[model samples]
Target: MTDAPRPRALGRKSIRPSLVPRDLMGDEELAGVWTAQVITLLPQAFPGVLGESLTGRALQEGVWALRTIDLREFGEGRHRNVDDTPAGGGAGMVLRADIGAKAMAEAVSRARGDVPRLLLSPRGRRFDQAMARDLARRDGVILFCGRFEGVDERLIEQFGLAEVSLGDFVLTGGEIAAQALLDATVRLMPRVLGNHHSAEEESFSSGLLEYPQYTKPAVWEGRAIPEVLLSGHHAKITAWRQAEAERLTKERRPDLWRDHLAKLGRPEEDREL
Candidate 1:
């Protein structure tokens, strides 16, 4: 019998070097790339939503990078099987510990400096905007997209992989969450969004939902833009936005409102919504 084709990918490869077509990006465009290394069963899902709008443009400009390490490449035996029946028996196969560890090792070996490794799972810590901001400041990120019954617990413990969740719910796979997390981080990278202030004013940047915005065609369908916004007075506009943000947070997300109040050192009596 012929040996399995080694399941492709073989090992982690730098995608930034070839992200943009050679003719599309010049030498200077490749410098200071913020790399993201992904280990997944499905490599093609990447740059999915990320390959549009600002993130797409940034990828072409080399503001950041993406590389995929196909997990099957590290599978055992000629057939390249990466999962197996649960040790104690269960509903579905679990990704083999040895296989996961090998894939992670191979990916990390090719990475430079101290890059953070994350595994997307339902049981992990809740991913939030603050976490995205912290990650944006890092040199790069390595993400492992779990599938099936989930990865072996030992692999997570041994590799020090920080499991993270997009929210309380689960996903069919981590590819979408990976795209989301990357989009959140990449947009905050230098020169990615062009306007730094835009990132600051976005939701959760200030522990509150962003204020409502209105634009040209100030009057639309019998509704007018807020008078404060049209007033052309910066101070009043700023005050209005702040108050609106606070009110929305209080009404929609009491948890965030409480946290915001605590941060302000305001007494509980003053924290009434």
Candidate 2:
């Protein structure tokens, strides 16, 4: 087996912000590293939530790495203009293709064109747990955070950028979306969560939402913890959780429930009764 990666010498207060994709080209020491390069108009928004809790701990340990490519650095003109009025005219301006292309090309060149290039756009494929899991297995990912009304479509096609969406909703910018995506993927990395199975058992791992959880209190407010959960019988508890998960999915997300049935090619024991 390959040896585990040696953690970088990083501290909470010692973290330095990168102004450019200077090391866009992967170096020997970074080989096999699960890095995330975020190209954003707002660089400060990154490692925002990612620098907290378990994800933060993992980052300091070098289980993964983050770098930012400031889009404004590549903007045109004396004022560093990155946006312009939309083609054919629109109420709000759109990000310029030249700027987007330059930023993406530089990032891709640094990675030697092997990394997955993603653009955060609402019209892109819906982000899901499966996508997060898939990304966790990659060497690294490059994210382009669009601002203004949207990005120039030509740049996306020219760079072959895969647009990905957080949901059916809209966001002002892609910084938050990038952070959210990274958070989901990073936690799946080895040693990040401490308990790898925790990731597997969480929502969408088994194509269903997670079962409800209860803590120390045997009774809360007027409600007692489920008797099965408190019984300390591992087998019974597992079965109970499976049943609840199935029931909840069927009631709340019939689409997932149907897909789950299709994958299994038959009903699960929980649904049999």
Candidate 3:
């Protein structure tokens, strides 16, 4: 008997490295990937560990590009500071609109195509897998990372910044969120992760949470792998995993599972959950 051949990727690899032929990208034409430019009061604050991990590897390999702009570079007056007290009397300092605006404009001038400008803010649309996939297809992006209280709202409005939020929680600054957005997005770019299937099978890939995964050790601390997984029948194993994934989602994140069901056009089922 022959071993099962590796499952062929439906078409070309998600990421056909530029070194490869251009015709391979299918009709998608992965000609220009999105470049990210983060505008912040402290540019050095960026490319932190977030940039060093898998995301950093993507940058190094030219899967994507990142640029950080210090808003102070465009500050007015002798001090070169880029923030000021809020006009309406806020708790902390607010980043000046003029400075941020100028910096973002400069970043815009440096990049190509219609870029989606994002302002990491508490008042924006919550970021999620759908947002990540959407951003990955764009040509470029400019992330405005607010410091102190926040950036001048007028600048965000005038620049048409799409206010994006990571969650309801607050953070010290938007730089962290920007980095997170970058990391999530770069991974979606073709070829960033060598195993393309990993992306397709991971949580949120199929609009459903990922099924649990296990490794070589059959037992650890007396905890054994599930009996079904140990069963040699391939069909039974796949069915068990799908059932388990659905059950886990129903138990842990019923809301997500509900949405998934809706997407699947399933009849609504009332649950005490």
**Model-by-model lDDT, in order?**
0.83, 0.82, 0.77
Candidate 3 off by > 4 Å:
1-33, 270-272
Residue 217, candidate 1: alpha-carbon lDDT = 97
Steric clash pairs (candidate 3)? 15-190
Tens-digit lDDT track of model 1 for 140-231: 89999999889999999998899999998978888888988999998988878878999999899999999998898989999999988988
lDDT of 1 at 32: 48
Candidate 3 lDDT tens digits, 104-175: 888778777867989999888999988898888888789988778887879978888899999999998898
Candidate 2 lDDT trough over 10 residues, lowest sum:
21-30
Clash count of each predicted structure: 0, 2, 1
Model 1 reaches what TM-score against the true structure? 0.87
Candidate 3 lDDT (Cα, 0 to 1) = 0.77
Among all windows of ten consecutive residues in candidate 3, which has the lowest summed lDDT?
22-31
Q: Predict model 2's lDDT versus the native.
A: 0.82
TM-score, one value per model: 0.87, 0.86, 0.83
Q: Where does candidate 1 clash, by residue pair?
A: none
Each model's Cα RMSD: 9.2, 6.3, 8.0
